[model samples]
Target: MTVALASFSKEKLYPPAFDPGGLVYFGPMFDFVIGAAPDGSLSNETGALEAWEPNDDASEWTFTLRSGMKWHDGEDVTADDLVFTINEFASPDATCGGVCGALAANLASVEAVDEHTVKMTLKAPDVNIPAQFGPIEGSIMLLPQHHVEKVGWDGFESDPLGSGPWKFVSRELGQSISYEANDDYWNEGHQPKFKKLDVVLAPDQNTRVAMLKSGEADLIAISPDQVPVSQSDGFDILTVENTVFSEILFFKSSDPEELTHKLEFRKALALAIDMDEVIEAFYPEEAGKRTSGDAVPFSETTLGHDPDLEPYPYDPEEAKALLKEAGYDGSTIKIWTVTFPDGPEQKDVNEAIAGFWSKVGLKVEIVQSEFATLKEQIDKDGFDPAPGVAVTGFPTSNRPSVLTNMQSLMMSPDAGGSYRTYWDPKTADTLHAELAKIVDDATRDERLREINRELYEQYWSIPIAMKNTLYAAGDRIDGWEPISGISKVLSYETLRPTE
Candidate 1:
């Protein structure tokens, strides 16, 4: 049996490439060796790694591999393979971006302890170490060391080898990608029921929906607005609250004396916009909830979230008063957003924010670009200190007690992307470093609560709302589950055919 799904990608599949353009095509081919357990802890159910423990004052970590795991070529998986994959991430010459680069920032060394065991040393102690290998998108993905070493980086891109349930078969760029189930897959009871898998690339949302309705596609991703209109016949609409926070960032300019760098200016801008209006305009009534105070909205479930803090109230009058006190010289402030696949048009939301800011006597300019271009600009040198505001979703993790989200989203540019925060970078980094050393639950909780309060009071970044991810599946598809770790992670592993 063959299962057909709709995926959006403009290029062919390329494994081990950290570029966003390549990651879009990598989901079906690669798998995170470690997966999150039922309670949001790390486990070895996927046979990526069976067990791991920290030693040497929490600076060194030892990992034990699961038995009987094999690569697509039928080669036995070993600790050497794991070491090689991590070395690629830790290499200075790697052109990777996003989570791969962020995680690699702290990797000091990786050594093979034995055939089934590997040990990793870190530059600093981190309580969120396991998440680097967790099932989140952009986390570490295991690669076949033999193939990569023989063919080299450039050659391996064209001939990718993976140990996941699916094996790459063929691809027609911007059209479709094909894969066959790994019959010799070592992991038991979790294999895909289908013999063959085909992913049709349809960049248009309407075309994807039409394909699902016409039986050309069995499953497709759709926006919340399309859910009500597309859920009539044999389709099942599955919704999951994403571990992502859609927020507006206020960047500091290269010149420290810029208007955006002023605390009063940033506070007034935050006060002028009504989050309820923004949520109601772009999101369906049941799709998104109003969120404020937290850097990542879903972070309330994390350890650092403070429940007692209140969000900044929406008051245009107060905004105007603050602006008056700051010396009334009108200047056009810039805001940026980009287009995304099967999601709300963020450009529209930015325009609404501009309208709100304009009412408070602030001149606003909404800058738009493609997602790829925006990411490139954010990663470029001196981009962090550039003066402008941009709108994008901040990614959080599913780990219940981890500080990975906090360190990535707010602490430093190396952990987080190059996005600038409202507070002093050095001070924020120092505070987070101190937080990382605490292993006691009580001490950690108290420190986290204090940091959460500071984040709210300092207005680091203005959080807009939490987003809901929606997927459309057909009647023939059964046993399908909502995505857990990251959006679109391991979706095929849990699916089976009803007919």
Candidate 2:
């Protein structure tokens, strides 16, 4: 089987350093301790751990590995490997953000209770422990301790070893990677249906669609705009809705004189843009839907999602009034648009938003750049002057809990590594800490709703739309369904061929 991806990272193929795109290339070669099920819920059924239970206070957890599991190198998957992996994730060197950061913050100690059992003690109770460690885009994966001890990080990257359904065959930098099926895979029912897998990088959307049409690829990720054409071409189209949330982030400025620092100004910016028009113009009906601030669509399914919260109404007249009340001087407000991999129409969406703002008598400038360059700039020169407002997309499919999403986008930059800097760190951090300690479902859900309400009321960021990921499969493919709510981590093992 061959798959074409929209992007690939040139960085080393280490799980710790992987972005969502990197996961598509290397994820199949490694197994996870817990993962998102097809129904968009977290479960240990498909992971190395057979069962897990928490102690009386929910501060300590015990994970029992499935018996007879073997690593790619033939070593038994044991509690020692789980301990090593968790310790590494907590280490200072591990990439910390999202769930990884959550684990690092709460984990007090991890030990190998026996060959098949691992015990983890936390500094404080966390009801979202499973979610924090599940195989989401930003979460870490279980590593082979023996392989790493023998070869080190560099060597492991060169020749990765894992207990996944596929084994590393070969690769070409920035071009393609190949893997062979692991016939001896522990889970017989979930073994790869195909014998071999080849993943190629075709960053351009047109190029990827062309490859799919020409029968050069079995599957390709595509934009919504290409859906009509692909469907006409008789290719099977697969879609997963509410996978990514595209929004405009308001970066905090210490200078109160700046428009972004003013509450009315932020609200004005939110109300000016007409999301319905934007969706109609750039996306198909099934591909996009308006969303409330910091919350993705289908909020009912996501924990902490507030049902009453609605997207800011499109009221240009009110927006103009608010702008006037804020004493706007019509200064040029730059909205940075990035060539993000997951957001194919980001430039178009930002352009439409700029037009809306212009109609409201606000001076808006669209500054275009690559996502990498923009990220580098933000990292180097903390949010102060530049990046006043930028258009970007975030994956919201962190299963079993939405706190991970809230932590990343709503929490203070110092605490959550959020790109948005306008939030009050002390207040957001305190709220998050409180939410983490509660174990009751009803209490947790109520608190989550409160957080969402707070973000919406404050205009934390301009909620735009929830985007559905589209994919086209060739005729040779049969019975392949992507896990809902996750845009990354294409479960190649689940793909079946036409018999």
Candidate 3:
């Protein structure tokens, strides 16, 4: 079977490091102790983990490895390997950086208790530790210590080893990758039913769709606009109201008196654009619902989302009034966005926003760049002297926990999370400190409410719409369905031939 992806060809087949940031390398190449189900629920699919428990202080966590587990090379999986991988990820010099740093931030030490038991001591208690380790967005995954130690990073990247359901057969850069079923895989029921698996890197969305139509590929990722068309051709369509969002991020102003710094200015900008129209233009109705606050609509199902709150009305007149009251001349404010595929035309959507903002007596400048370059620029010097708003998207947590939502979506930038609108280092830390002390579920709910309200009240960043991710597959694919959450790895083991 062949699968087509909209993503570009990866330069490296596997990560060269043993860290959480490098977990993407492990996803296709290795197995982890725990993984996320299609709906984003954590599960011990491979039985790598028998059980786990946290100590009384909540600072120490102990995990018991499933006995008799073997690596692809037939080496016994032991507690020592787990300990080594964790410590390596925690190390500051890890090659895979940002996420690696975030994953190991609170780690104090990791020790092997015995041949089957491992202990981790954290500097601070974190309730969402499991999610951090789970295979949600390629965070925590295990590696074979023996193979990596002997072969080293360079050799390991070229020739990776793992006990996953599929073993890598060959990879042709800018072409395709092939794999075969891992017959010796511990979990027999979940093993790949198909004799072979192949993935092609078709970056073009139309090309992917065409390939699917031509029977060149069995499965492919499609944009919302392409969903109905694919369905019309008798292909199966899976739409998940994912925890993904398209939002406008505000950067701090070089001058405190600038329009970007004013709460009224931000509010006016929010009021000026019609999100409903935007949604209709860019996404299918099945793709997602409009969001009221900084969070996506799926977040409303969580603890803190206020049901009574309403999205800002599209009122250009009010926007003009607010801008006038804030003493803003018709000065041009720059906005930026990047090119992306398997989604709406971001450039056109951004231009629409600029047009709406313009109607309210604001001059607009639109700057465009590639996603990678723009991301680098934003990370290094967030609007530095060249202050402007940048357009971007964030994938939300599929977990039903408030901690998961906050940590992944709106936690402060200093906390290694991406809530950079207000750009305060101390805000998130203070809130998290308060949250850590509250043990009552009801009390935590109230606290989360307060936090959610505060974020909305500030209007630092405005969420435009919640995005729905759609997947299309031919009838030959089975056991696959549309899931509305952030599970990066679809359990390929569950996928099989329908015929």
Best by TM-score: 2
Q: Deviation in angstroms for 167 in model 3?
A: 1.5
Query: Model 2 clash pairs?
Result: none
Clashes of each: 1, 0, 0
TM per model? Answer: 0.90, 0.94, 0.88
Computed on alpha carbons, the lDDT of every model, listed in order, comes to 0.65, 0.75, 0.65
Candidate 2, residues 193-259: lDDT per residue as tens digits?
Answer: 9999999999888898888878899999888788888889999887775677776676553336567
Error of 1 at 363 (Å): 1.0
- lDDT assessment of candidate 3: 0.65
* lDDT, candidate 3, 245-360, per-residue tens: 66777655323645667778878888889878887887677667676553431255466667766777888888888888777776667776665542445677788888888877
TM-score of 3: 0.88
Q: What 10-residue stretch in candidate 1 is worst by lDDT?
A: 1-10
Per-residue CA lDDT of model 1 for 1-499, tens digit only, reads 3333344444534343454334435666665657664344466776488887887456788888887888888888888988987887666655444455555777888899889899888888865666656655345678788988888777765777888878888877667767888877776566778888887777678887778878888777777677677666657776555444567666553236556556666678789998788888777743555664554422565666676777678999999998887664886677766655434556677788889999998877777767667666766765643333545433333434545554544455655545554446666677657866776657887887777776666665677766565667877787565355455453575677887
Q: Which of 1 and 3 is the better model by TM-score? A: 1
Which ten-residue region of model 3 has the weakest summed lDDT? 16-25
